[model samples]
Target chain A: MRAVIAEDLALLRDGLARILRAHDIDVAAAVGDPVALAAALEEQQPDIAIVDVRMPPTFTNEGLVAAIEARARRPGMPVLVLSQYVEQLYARELLLSGAEGVGYLLKDRVSEVGMFVDTVRKVAGGGTVLDPDVVTGMLTHHGRNQAMARLTRREREVLGFMAEGRSNAAIAGKMVVTAKAVDKHINSIFMKLDLPLDADDNRRVLAVLRYLQTD
Target chain B: MAREDADRAALRDVNWRMILRLEASISVGIGLLMLIIWALAGARHFWPAWVWFGLAIPLALQVAIRRGLRAPKGHRLLAAHGAITCVLASILLAIWLLAGARHAFWPVWPILGLGVVLVGHAWVRHALPTAREQALADRVEVLTRTRRGALDVQAAELQRIERDLHDGAQARLVSVAMNLGLAEELLSKDPQSLTELLAEARSSTLTALADLRTVMRGIQPPVLADRGLEGAIRALALDLAVPVTVGGEIPGRVPVPVESAAYFTVCECLANVVKHSGALQARVDVGYRGGVLSVAVRDDGVGGASLAAGSGLRGVARRLEVFDGTMTLTSPAGGPTVVTMEVPCELSSPRT
Candidate 1:
């Protein structure tokens, strides 16, 4: 998959480009700041864009805003947002465009090269991914926390992995349980959270997240 | 400023003196005319004395007004009182002398009344703070409190940062060092054991990095540094568990120290809302107007939050006090708690 990377830090930007190129994923453009990122997006039209939360000029949420604007121009333009810190609010905002083809993770996740590459591929292939920290943050303080509390421990575990855009089989492998059992736990979570059951994984993740945010 | 006012007052005095001289000339001419008329009609009874007293009334009032204006600022009212009292006493003396001082000294009663009122005015002026001194005293009181508060906040911040580093990053680095040493020893013997030890070391270093990041954030958040107070607040609002609607704007960046203090104050308020309020939603409003930067955090929660109730908010208050800032909280027992903090400030250029 072809990709574009936008990060202000030179060290991190080069590292990202090198990683994607090593993974046989073509990195068509790597730039700093939203202005350059915008120009690159227009020219390259990469399969995915990896963005940092803070970028110049006015190094605030410029890159995050750029990613959203890019998606607005072309719906479901797969983008993965990275930040030094994880925030449920930024995650919710990124997912607002379309949970599918979106991922929000901490910048530290780049160190786990295999997992990072897999996330980029999953996002480019139209799957939603959120950091486990964001999910934990959601489960602890959101208005939906009470609903999360009603979930059984095993079912909540399944829900967490599911929100991270893992398939039932991937979740089963992580839990060392059967795939069918993982599916059952997911179903139980949906029912307990009072969400409509869905066949698509991204929609199921979105439904859980829609309720996971503040009511 | 005082010199200019005095010069203007002197010019006014000269004008008044010129008018007084003309009036005095006119009065003496009238009195002399009356004297001549009395002599022509066989002088008797001396009724011109009453006419002179009537003329003195207007002159006395103008003199009293000028005395009030000429007195120093704090003493103006008392000067006016004394001048009016003297005028009344002089009138009483004139009445006594004109009425043939053989009576029971009735002028003493009216003169004594005027003296008593003037003395009372002087006593009150001495006892209470006059306008200028009172304002100075108030300013001194504020400066003293805020200076002490700034020192206290500085000391407390230093202590907290030291403790966090000692327990978090320092401890993790120690573990990582030990793990790396063990990995080095195992490298010559068992590759499997060495690999596990190396992985553990890497994990420990990552944890240490996370710890350092947290401490850095506490000291100065990256977003706050990038965005200034207005945008920093919006970023903070987004992170809270409760849905917070952020409103208002600032024209330019706040100074770094003030920006950090305001950001932490809002952070503490939000943390309280999440922990104590159990409310479904919250609101944060930030605006700068008329040289005052104000931030109000409102939560729809069970209230009863007070500064005396928790050290967290009190610390926030102290932190703000250093900047000559103030916080007011209104949280009645049932719902809708609002905490508003204001700081007098000037907007700095966007970046230094």
Candidate 2:
């Protein structure tokens, strides 16, 4: 897959580009600052865009804005956002646009090269992959909600993995449970959340996120 | 200024001494002349005694007035009044005795009038403050309050830093150390788990670094040192989700303590803009004029922001209070929010 990277730090930007290249992913353009990121996204039209939450000219959330704008210009355009810190508020804002083909992770996750590469490829393939930290934050925030209060302990655990864009098999592997048990847990979670019983994993993930996003 | 004041006081003292010496010499010369006149005119009826008493009374009154004038300002008026009244009363009583002790006691009336005047003079002296004194009192009150607030904020900040470090990086490092020890114990026996343990240790180390960085940033941002307030704020503006237009010139650097307080205040306001205000754009204007550094952050967002909400803005306000700074928030219900903060400070020359 072809990707474009937007990171202000030269070290991190080169590091990301090098990592992706080693993973056999082509980095079409790697640029610093939001203005250049916007131009590169427009010109390259790469399969995915990896962005930092902070970049020039204002280092606050320009990268997040650029990614949202990129997706707005091209709906479902895959984008992975990385930051030193992951705020639930920023995650909510990012998901508000659309959950599909989006990934928000902390920069620390890049140390896990295998997982980082997998997440990038997953996002490029139009999957929703949120950082576990972001998922944990969301769960803590919404834990007391009426719908969330109805979830069993095991079901809540399953729901967290689901929110992190894990497949049933992957969730089963992590939980050390059989695939059938993981499937049953997911079905129960969907029912408790009052979501439709969607069979597609990606759609199911979106549905679960939509339910979580509600007040 | 001290040297000039000392010189002026010395000159006044010399003048007072010269005047006293001249008065003394003149009185002696007059006394000698009177005695000579009495000795030459056939000594009888002792009328020269009256002349001597009259001259002594005026000299005594002059000395009293001069001394009263030299007294400190608050007591000067009262002292002068008392001195004049005493001299006048004594002179009147002497005249009464010299006039063969009047039976009606007429001196009491004049004495009563002098007492009333002196009382009024004392009242006036204590009742009002001079402009300089009033200003000084006001400045002392402000300094006392701000100094206490500064100390309180500083104490609280240090406590928070300690708590954060203890719970965050320090705890993480302990975990990392434990993981390393475990890996060492399982080095050969469970080589399979050794890699996992090492990875966990490395991850904890990274987390500790992140924690340390956050704490360091809270204490003092490196960017703030590299760029002064204006430049640092400009850098901050670049990081926001909405485009922020930074205007005005600061000319030079504000004192570091005040600058940090102001910068954090601006950061808090901007954070509110991002979280609470659904504004499309924001702007920061900074300027220094009339010895006050002014910063105003305005957002075209949903308003209704208030300090009473117990938001972080209240903490920011308290922090600014330590520097004798002020914050004003104007956020109407419909749209547009403006936060203006001003600190009285002087800017130093820009660092080369």
Candidate 3:
């Protein structure tokens, strides 16, 4: 898989490229600045581009602009954006651009190598990935929906884990319970919210996210 | 200046006219007195021929008067000469009148004294010290204001440095210390194996490193130096909870001092809006016109703001002053406080 990387900091860009290359992923080109990356995008076509949310010449939203430009030029290209903080406005902007094959995740997610790689693969394969924290932050503060208001605290925790794309076994380990009990909690949450019982991680995450994200 | 000089010259011409009128009147009176003397004692040798020599006094007075009028701002000398001539001329006229026809020549004595008073009062009242004193006072005031503005700017810069250090580096160091303390406790307990404890120590080290870098960035924002004002401000807005509508654009790179002041002003303004204001939105506009860079931050929040000592407004005012700039705040009691800060790019450095 061919990918382009745009990050303002040299160390972070080099580190991310090394980690991706170690997983046998081809980094077609890596740029430490946004302007050069934009020019490169015009010349070279990459299947996927991983961008940092802030980059130079102005460290503000160069990454967001780069993502928009790439999507505009090649609508089929998959882009994953990394940010230090979970910002609702940025998430809204990304989701509003037709959510297929787009990903927004915290930079710290790279610590979980397996899940991070899986997310990259999913995004490249035409799936949408949203950071569970971003969804949680947005829903917790501003959500006024009745179904969300009725969720028990334990059910909310389960929902959070689900949104993080966690398997039942992992949720069980974190909750210190049997996987059978975790399964029951997940089923109870799905029933209370009246969502389809899809077993796929992406679809399950999307359904829960779409419900919680509703106003 | 030319107009004023012309006005003075016109006044001088008027004074000359007055003196000429006095001399002409006196000349006609003296000629009348001579005719009366000749009529009383026919042109024979009753009076000595040398007595006619006293007539030279009036001619001499006219020469002195004309000379005084020629020089600019020399009214004192000119007026003195005219007054003396008028007094001497008056005494002669009085003696001649008493000796011959005895007309009331003493009336002209009062007119002579009036001229002296007029010249002396004009010099003392409006022409001399008022103009010089005013110029001196103005110079002193301008110097004082410039000095005060310079001092205020420097003091504000120092205050900002203190604030950044206290909030950023100091706070991070405290957290680092706490993290290290916890890691040490875990090491001493050995509840986990040596490997796990080492990992904990490693994690603390990484946390400290990250915190320190954050502190460094907060101090200066290295990206601003590398990129420009636009990039730095956008980065700041991206993290705000409320909507930040950026209006207008800044062209090219500004000098570091200008950029730093503008950057911090925006930062402080945004922080106050988020923390204090119940407003849902903010607007920031930046533009350049006629060599001045203008920055304005407005919020639709409760707007009772004061620059009472120790307020952030005071600090901002001082900061702008350093760049030969000013900060004006228009905040009423209920809503909408607009802070406008303007600074000239190429002004003489403020001197204390």
Candidate 4:
């Protein structure tokens, strides 16, 4: 898969490009600023883009806005946002462009190379990935607490992993449990949230949509 | 209740004038009664004239004091001194007349003494404070105190940041470097241990970054920069454990320093709400009205939050006072606690 990266820091930009290249994903264009980033998105139209939250020319949320605008032009355009800090408002803004093919992770998460690359691949494949802080941020909405409070500690863990875009097998592997157990936990979570049973990926998107409507 | 207050106020309002007028009339009656006595005694020397002059004392003092009160700014006391001199001269003249106008003008000696005192008083009265000077001195006092408080808060904040960086991120980075150096040494002999060290170093760097983020947030939150005060407050309300309903509107951004001060105050107040107030719910209201930015945080719980009770709020008040701001708290026991803070500032036009 082809990808574009827009990070102002040269070391991190080069590091990201190297990591994606090592994973056999083509780095179509890696630019340092949003201007070049916009041009690259228009010309190359890569399958996915990894953008930083802060960038040059008013170094506040430039890359975030660029990503949102790009997705506005092309619905569900895959983009993974990286930032030094995790804020719920930014997460919600990114989710507003439709939860599919989007990821928002703290810059620190890149240290977990295996998980970071897996998240990139999942996001490029039209799946969702959210930082744990970001998930907690969205879940802190007013009325969601009652429904989420009904979940057991283990079910909550499974729910968190699900929100992070892990499949049933992946969650079972992480939790050291059988795949059927993971399926049962997810079913229980869905019942508690009062959501219709659907495919796993669709349910993740609906979870976000359901809470967003409450506000 | 209202009628009682009105009647009491009416009584108080007329008291001074009524008392003065009644005394003057009684003095007149005494003068007339003495005139009748003198008339019965034979009325040749006109001794009633002395009685009228003596009766003039209270009326004369009243006139003099009324004029003193009406005297312009610094001249009130001097006017009062001038009134005393007049009263003294009049009394001495009356005594001289009563003394059969003899003994080498003895009243002149005492009158000279009065003249000396009046001159001294007039000379010193100008040096005393006028109303405007007193007001300016009060302003200067506030400026001095707030400046010192601000410096103290700043010094304490700098020390905290320095200590946090020294102990947290910088130490982590040093450990990361040490681990990396050891990992390189083990790369040839122990490949498995080498991988473990590398993993540890990676996590250490991430922790260092986290520590740095915390320090940077203490300085100035990036979210506050992304969105101004109102939006920043909303973002803060979301992260809180208690459900905080943030209400109100801000048309344009306040100055950055003021915004920072106001934001941190809200943060401190909300922290208190979570920690001390056994509150089930909290609320924040932010609005800019009449060139003043006001923020009030309220919680429904066991009340009694006070600046004197906690250094957290005292520091908050000190920070706000630097900008000529004010903070008021109303946290009666067994009820809701509300902290209201306000700062007067002009807003620049909103950025497009």
Candidate 5:
């Protein structure tokens, strides 16, 4: 899988390129700055673009901007953004646009190289990987607490399963209940949490998030 | 809170201010004397004048060294400016005196004294206020630091609440919820016990969640970050009973620290306006000027507000001082109270 890396620090960029290449992922172009990363991506379109949250010139969110630009150019290409800290607002901006095929992780996660690569691979395969810390921080907000309060104990248990990406059957099996019972629990959760009961692949994720937020 | 304690705090700030003024004025005077001596001594002969200039260099450096001394709040800048005047006056006075004062140079002393008269006049004009203002400034600082300390305590309380939810209440609730689900399934077998257990669990969950939400709101409001500053402040203004007209345009995105400071300042100002001022309306203005973020809160209330009374305004002054910012409160006995705070924007570009 070919990838373009945009990071402001030369040492980090080179180090990340080396690590990715070691994993047999082809590093198409490694640029120390986002402008060059953007130019390189235009010249040599890669399968995935890994960007830093901060990059050269206007270091604040330049990498995020570059990733957005690349996605704007090619909607299908996956992008991974790495940041130093858990910024809930930044993560929300990324998720609210669409959670599919996107990854936002802390730079400290790079120490766990295997997990970092796995996350990257997940994004490339059209899956979302939000930093668990970011998820926890966002859920800790006052509004989320209010929402969480409104959930039934059983519904809240189902949400924990759903947040782990479990299906209705999987959740029902875990709870030792019938699939119909699980469906009832989910419908109750949806009504209580006031979430849009839409039919979509990502609705489970949305439902889990809404449950986590309110109840 | 007592009269004696308030008087002592006022005295302490005044003492610091006096020391600042004295050190500044003396340094300037000595430097001036040195410059005059150097000029006269040097002008006696060009060769010796250079020697006098060399002698004045050490004194000039001494004055430069004094500039490094830390002065309290507004006094630092004033002290430094006063010292500067002495050095500049010495240089100009030396030239005028050495040249024999025969030409248009005599008027230089008046020009030099103009700065002294201007600063000294302003200094003396505000002399009664200098002590009170310095006290108020110091008090505001103390209050802000205390409030920040209170905030830290509040944040700690939040962390504890989070831990409590995870380890104490949420854990028990999870078990209760699980047991309730089981109880619901076996309701026909033991309807009475199952119903009681389920009811107990439901009450426990609701109480735990309510406690968690109350604690979390103190840390940060989700709406503030969600809808941005305008929404946050608008929400705040709505809560205020007194008519608070909030003016000034908020940027689409302000630095988090800047917004936090601005938010608290407005909150505190309105609180003060409500608690102390018998006012009809208060206005809070926030905007950026010359790369410095400015917040001005004005209340058309019965003023006579003094920071010496350990009013939280003193704390406000100190909080602003942390970022090299300032808070000025002007409250006349009968009318409007205007509190202005300005903070420098020192954004270190994160570039290689």
Candidate 6:
């Protein structure tokens, strides 16, 4: 997979590029600012773009804006945003842009090279992968809502993994349960959340996230 | 100030005593003249008694006026003035009675005038605030506003610290624990990938430490606690992309709260200089004079910075305002930007 990286810090930018290269992912361009990032995205049209949340000329959400703009120009363009901190508000924004081909994770997650590489690939393959912190924040914020209150503790756990873009089998592996049990929990979650029954994992994840994002 | 007030009170007392003595001496002289007139003139008619009464009237009025003047400021002054008016009216009535009963009661007009004057004086004195009272009231207002602002800033700082710890280092450590758990699960079955998992877990620990250090710096920079504001700022300036010249002397330790607020305000300004101003170079000047500590940050850059433009400087201003401090920005377009912040506070004695 070929990718473009936009990170203002030279150290972090080079480190990200090196990691992707080690994972057999080609970094087509490594740019430092939003302007250059935009230029590289247009010129290279790489398979994925890993962007930072803050970059010059304004170090406040410029990278996020660039990523959204890139997807606007080319729909379903995959972009993984990494930040030192993750805000629920920002996660809502990135998802609102479109759930497909989107990822938001903390910069520290890069230390887990295997997981980080897997997340990048998952996003590039048109799957949404939200950081666990973002998912936890959303659940905590919406846990008291009437619809969410109906979910059991185990079902809520299943829903959280679903929002993190985990398949039923993956959730089962994490929870140390059989895939059949995971499927049952997911069906229960869909019913409790008042979401339409959908078997496709991506569509189900989107439906669950859209429900959580509503008022 | 206490000693000065005491001296003023003593001088007033001495003046009052001298006036009393002078009035007594004058009354004595007038009495002697009246007695001489009674001895020389036909002694039976006693017209000299009228002269004696006339002299006593003025002596009585003088004593009353002096007593009125001696009362302390505020309502007492009005009270004294009222007393003097009443005494003078009584003296007028006495003179009228001693001269033969007046057909029209003529002293009533003068008494009415005096009453009007006394009422006017009382109203004026009661309505306007004294200079000292106004100053104290203003100080109270400032204390109330700044006290509330300080509490708000403190609470916000604490909340931010809590959030940073929870989201930064704490979250990273949890991830590290998860990685270790996964490594343990795979130890015997997937021993080949165990090495990579262990390395990742170790790296996670280091990242957690880095996150902790960043959070600690946000709370209270160790450098700032070790060195004063000047030294701390100098250390900060060294790390900036653009060269920053820090020129200042903070001779003694400032109260820790004020020092922290000042340090953060300066840091915010410098961060603006780096992130927005696009300056090639910057300068910082710090000084304390007349109980006011002032810091000026100047950068030669694109300029046009303002509180309304971004929350960065506005946050700084709010932080300073918690200490009754002020921030002034002079960043016209196409030139240098200068931000001057002043906080009035006393410093401890110079460190030995």
State which candidate has the highest TM-score.
Answer: 4
Q: Which ten residues in a row are the worst by lDDT in model 1 chain B?
A: B231-240
> What stretches of model 5 exceed 4 Å from their correct place?
A142-149, A152-200, A208-215, B1-248, B251-316, B319-352
For each candidate, what's the DockQ? Answer: 0.23, 0.04, 0.07, 0.47, 0.03, 0.01
Q: How accurate is candidate 1 locally (lDDT)?
A: 0.84
Candidate with maximal DockQ: 4
Candidate ranking under TM-score, highest first, comes to 4, 1, 6, 2, 3, 5
Question: What is candidate 1's CA lDDT for residue B246?
Answer: 88
Can you tell me which runs of candidate 1 are displaced by over 4 Å? A141-153, A187-205, A208-214, B1-36, B39-50, B89-120, B131-139, B174-194, B220-309, B320-352
The pairs that clash in candidate 6 are: none
Instruction: Give the candidate order by descending lDDT.
Output: 4, 1, 2, 6, 3, 5
Q: What lDDT is obtained when candidate 3 is compared to the true structure?
A: 0.70
Worst 10 residues of 5 chain B by lDDT: B343-352
* Better by TM-score, candidate 6 or 3: 6
Over A72-191, each residue of candidate 2 has an lDDT whose tens digit, in order, gives: 999989999998776655676688778888899989888889889999998898788888977775565444357877878888888788778787889999999999999888777777
lDDT of 5 by residue, A52-149 (tens): 88766755566776777677777756888987544555655565555666778767667567767877786787666677655554333323356666
Question: Across residues B227-285, which tens digit of lDDT does each residue of candidate 5 receive?
Answer: 44555676566456575667776455556665566566667788888888988777888
Task: Rank the models by DockQ, top first.
Answer: 4, 1, 3, 2, 5, 6
Interface RMSD of each: 3.2, 10.3, 6.3, 1.9, 13.5, 16.5
Worst 10 residues of 4 chain A by lDDT: A206-215
Q: Which regions in candidate 3 have their CA more than 4 angstroms from the true location? A: A6-14, A28-47, A52-65, A82-98, A103-119, A126-215, B1-194, B209-217, B220-256, B277-303, B330-352
lDDT string for model 1 (B218-278, tens) is 9988878766877677767766668778888888888788888899999999999999998
Compared with the true structure, model 5 gives a TM-score of: 0.42
10 residues in a row with least lDDT, candidate 2 chain A: A136-145
RMSD each, Å = 5.3, 12.6, 10.8, 10.2, 19.3, 19.8
**Candidate 1 lDDT tens digits, A129-181:** 88887777665554445776677878777777877877788899999999999
